[model samples]
Target chain A: MKKKNDWPFILPAIFVVAVMTQVPFLLTVVYSTLRWNLARPDMPIVFSGIDNYLFFLKIPDFTVVPEFYSIVLQTIIVTVVALVICTVIGFLFSILLDHPIPGVNIARTLIMGPFFVMSTVTGVIWKTTILNTTFGWYGVLAKSIGLAPVDLLSYYPLPVIIFLFCWQWIPFFVLIILAGLQGISGELVDSMRIDGLNWWQSTFRVKLPLIMNHIRVAVMLGLVFIVKEFGLILVTTAGGPGTRSYTLPYQVYMQIFSASNVGRAGALATMTVVLTLLAVNFVSKSMKKNNL
Target chain B: MRANQTLSLQRTAQIKKVIKMVALTVTIYTLAILYFSPILYMLISGFKTEYQAVSPSFVFTPTFETYKSVLSDPSLYGYLGNSIFQVLASSVLCLLLGLPAAFALAFGNFRKKGTRDKIYMWFLTTILLPPVAVLIPLYTWFHAWQLNTTPLGLLMAYVGFHVPIVVWMLYSFFADVPTEIMEASEMDGCTRFQQMMHIAVPLVRTGIISACLLVAVFIWNEFFLGFNLTGNDTATLPVYMSRFREQQGMFIAQLSASSTIAILPAIVVGWMTQKSLVKGLTLGAVKG
Candidate 1:
């Protein structure tokens, strides 16, 4: 069989990806080593020889590095909490709905609504309508009870933000895990039941083991998502309360756009990319080994 | 003796059933309220007038004044049009560039499989890199190329950022398509381009459509790129909303109305392609 080498067919996309994505990425790396600002057009690009990185390390208010670290911590917290809660809830629901349940499809549809909402819209809704200290619905409810309304934005922003994130993402985790659960064979479950294994043992030892890969993949994907997230943080808290809620991506945003420090921002961005790569790679490899 | 054993088993089953029912009911009620409350708030606020928006009352006379204002605003329409055009352009451009590359990577025989794999990994790495990392350099390049503040510039950035993921997705779908189909197409004297357009394209049409829809939503909802890249002429809905918030402050009930409008297209697309959307979200799973 004569297979034609289709470089002609492939060249356009390769060129497009290389020129647009790869070239820009390389330029970013190059620019990270140089001193230049958008505001000063005449400033010659001076090769600073790790000065950008050294400055980031030395400066107190170069909050990008510490801020990125804090963001990573916040991402870990939010992702793990959300993933665990959503997985448990999702698994329980899937098991319940596996049996004959009334209005199951309707319940499913309502549950899936959050997954469809744009992240920005979700952020806006939470910030203005629900969690806003002044005109928010929660505030009204508190006022109606003749109690001093709690300031969610100031007092406990992280937990409140985590709660909102979990609320939006739990439905997604539920849907995916439910789909995985649905794919499990019934005969295997029945056999396990016949062996006098209680529902708890059957779920933990049997069903969960079988669906562990799917769960891992879902959790890892969720981690990537939560880590890369910016819109919610931007809209809801804007990393307020003295940068308490700042995540890596938003930190990068602040450094580049707000502080006009592109080199430091580039270093932060590079570090984030490296961290995410390592995390994702570790997760997938571990899952593969365990599955084997 | 057998009757006694059967009765006890039946009783145990009945108790289990009751417990499961109770557990499910409590879970459903709690989750439903948690998930729906914010959305309900948004919908309700969309109907409130400017005066009522700031009032700390859940119970208020509903009004369509916000929606009316949003619809009547000329800038709102212009922003919406810009968003629509930009999203459509980005989606089409991503598909055009990504599909063939995905085909080559997934189906074609390359001498350097390792290199191809590296390219694939490099693409995935882009998703992790903060968009800000490239913003300054890309902005400078845009100015140098006279591409700044243009819809085409925004579209190019959108396509550049998104094509990798689209390729990653379509690669999996293309891999799933049996090699026999391509073999058969080749046997019929069809060129590689013909094989792709006539054979592979149709085979992965579902994947293509899903990728396009997902990319469209991302592009439409994109803020950083559009906000930084476009001025008034090419500003997207997100940029418009941000400006509205900054300019009008609390007086703008129209921001909520505009937000609801901005999200409508994505919501509709998501509803139509719920299964595909889920599959797209979990693309890594099915492949590995």
Candidate 2:
């Protein structure tokens, strides 16, 4: 009776999750194997096993490698660089805020402000106010110093995007690491100090090892966020300069909305799901290992 | 012997204190500037006149014209209303569906743990899948259902996309509540619903609030889903802001103002719940 009663309560949520998330994913896999386009409605969905995948592999786009590899490479580069920078900086900031310093709360608030700003806002703020070649603050400053103002969007698209990604995501890492820092028992650190360990030794030998799980979680969350990021790309470059800034998600958007190739877009989406699953699985396994 | 040991301990503490202070100060200042610059720039740009905003000169006359422009537009209010309605409806629906499911999973020792875990994983896996993958087919599906360009349609989609994360976050929070509390309530003759309402609800209030705030911010800031799902009639702030480029051209100050307006609510909420906001952002890490 108790078991039967519980089923009604659980069923709605499970139903929603299955229908909304799982079903779409399954459909994406099915669509990837078929040939369909937006232009023709009456045309039957043709079953072309692996054809779309093969075609995508051969296509030469600046975003991906060889033809499609560049995009993936650029994305990997951006994600890695941004993750490393943000994690280090975030750790540093969290350590700072963890101190018994006055105004730490104020400083923390100021630092966290940017994270709340939507990606669209972040993109616009960087592009128009700071990096705009013609009228941006950086451009103005450069020109005043008797130097040519380089258009960030035009000259260093990938770096600019990577920098923005770092800026937006750093606070997230800071908050997480700070929470983890708080969780560390003070007595443990005191005991390490009593054993004649220096601050560096304590941090490296004691503090860091304890927070490994947190760090893993932070990195995984960061990876998921960076992989899924779209607003910044959309607002800033719109995957511009002939697809130089195209990442996997943007490519999927272009294929479906712009190119109207439903099957190819689905194929890209499937690949994204597979990659994300791999990342999630890897992170979870490492976390489990750390716990053990 | 004790005095000597104490003296040596004091000296070491002093040295450690100095190093820690120096490191903390430097890190704090650098992080402050790095994180705060873009937001400061945006807020400053919003107040500047078009000419001042565009000029190479750092010093400029500020004006309220941009704010005036954003406020005077009637559609801005409409967009704001639509955003509020959709976010509130979706969040409410997510909680209604999510809370019970979370309760059942956390408390009920269901027989099929494997099936349950698989379902949970499947839901989380949606976070990994990009929207464009299913965009076309979903579009066709929505169109067939006559849900395109409707607020209810958009809310349903938002609820669908968000419920998994909501469930996961709530589940973790619920799991942490001491089972003894629920068991105690049962011993006191409280029924399941009564126990959930009177016990579980109050205990997890912080979690519920955090989840709601996080979900609200996400719904507010969501662009692609809002862009694809809603037309002008149902557009949210992100979609409204996107229209600025096409409609207003390169009016830099006006654009900044609109951006500022769009981000204002999130900033306010983030400030209020800065602690939990951080917690929510790093939910995956803390749980793992």
Candidate 3:
């Protein structure tokens, strides 16, 4: 039923998406160019040109916590580490589930439960109940057994955040690779026997290769999702303990709400976008190269 | 002697298989319990008194006090109801706005497939774009228009964020609707709208439902946008829940009760759409 010009049917959606996504992006870039500090009434709004960009760019050291460059590195490390660990654990679970074990049905549902939990809930649950030093479940268990309950939140905040990230995200990898593994034809498994391949050999060779694309999808999606890990950070540590747990997004939030530095916020956001685009470019290029 | 040796080898192999099966079952149950322990712990804590809830004691008398206290707060239900309403509203809007576009892309007699692919990728990029980039400008624009805290503005934003998934998922669905049916409907003097409403939609009802479910879950769980955009009347459950967390005292039991309330619907919807969720989340790139 589509005519030669079906563009009219699509125009409204295109308009709304562009207005919401595209216009905001352009405006963010434009905002970065201005000295729009709401807190500092003494300094009027003016064209700051590339000054805003330089503000983040001119940070001298790469090791400084809460710094733009450092936060970018930290975000990458946290996201990549979490993604890798989650993928490994998720793949193991997927492989375990691939076999027809007794009571697998109920176990599968239970395993998938954490993925559905809200970000704030996961963060708050972990922070207040699971990781709370004096009153957490661990504390209760430890004290019952005649041991001291060390404060994980105070000493190991970033790892705790990463653990929370993995807990919430590993299930995603399970979903991805399990779908891929289920797609594998039974004939392939039969052929594994014909080829004299052992069970471990069959999984590593036949099963893993078949789901390489799915693994790639999981990792790529992880990159896309993990960078936006704000809600979890906001509730758990709020990037606390002197910025040891800070990420780029958290830093961006601080720049706006904490400092009220609109210019610097805009500039910092632009840099974050650039950093994200670089990873996106890599993902897309690798996706195409891998013929995914 | 050869028959006896073969029989012994086969028996040993059978024993190994049984052991492996038992181990896998044990591992599955163990991991499931470990993975779900956080939610279970929270649920238990919700029933514990304030001291025991904080103490994390296992041997405490259970109580419904926190649930009662949290539930008695009228605004909790209001925020939850608002979340439900907004999610439903945005999902419907996503479908209404996205279906036509998806249908156009899937069945249109476009000369170049590349144009179609590029347009689809453009939308895909928007979905993947770090939402923080847009937050500063959107907050400003919404504030300028006094639409930041309004349901209508928030609805539009959710629809915009969610439509790309709808378009992509429904594109795959509509593509599966055999063209012969559409052509036959066209021959019977049916309009494009009628063809979609009468034929294509009914054929792929499961697809549309799954797409909406996926979009609803995403929107319902979304934070940054809801956190920054809405207030008071438009406060989403997530934003409201965050506000509760920020308040003075640490009430783990109360917080758990609220968290359970906020997450209950998502769990139900998520379970129902478990299969289609993979498709919706991956935009039909990977199907379960």
How do the residues A9-122 of candidate 3 rate in per-residue lDDT, one tens digit apiece? 788999988888778888889889999986887988899899988887775665654366667777988987898898899999999888888778778778888888889888
DockQ value for model 1:
0.42
TM score of chain A per candidate? 0.87, 0.92, 0.93
Cα lDDT tens digits for candidate 1, A162-213: 7767766776677677767777888987888789999789878888877777
The 10 consecutive residues of candidate 3 chain B with the worst lDDT sum are B279-288
lDDT score at residue B106, model 2, on the 0-100 scale = 72
lDDT preference between candidates 1 and 2, better one: 2
Docking class of 1: acceptable
Whole-model Cα lDDT of every candidate shown, in order: 0.72, 0.77, 0.81
Reference-based TM-score of each model: 0.88, 0.90, 0.93
> Highest lDDT among the candidates is held by which one?
3
The parts of candidate 1 lying over 4 Å away from their true place are A41-43, A59-100, A287-292, B1-26, B51-62, B112-122, B143-146, B243-255, B281-286
Per-model fnat list: 0.34, 0.51, 0.61
Q: What interface RMSD do all candidates show, one decimal each?
A: 3.1, 2.6, 2.1
TM-score, candidate number 1 = 0.88
Q: Candidate 2 at B61: error in angstroms? A: 5.7
Q: Is candidate 1 or candidate 2 better by TM-score?
A: 2
- The candidate 3 chain A region of ten consecutive residues with least summed lDDT is A59-68
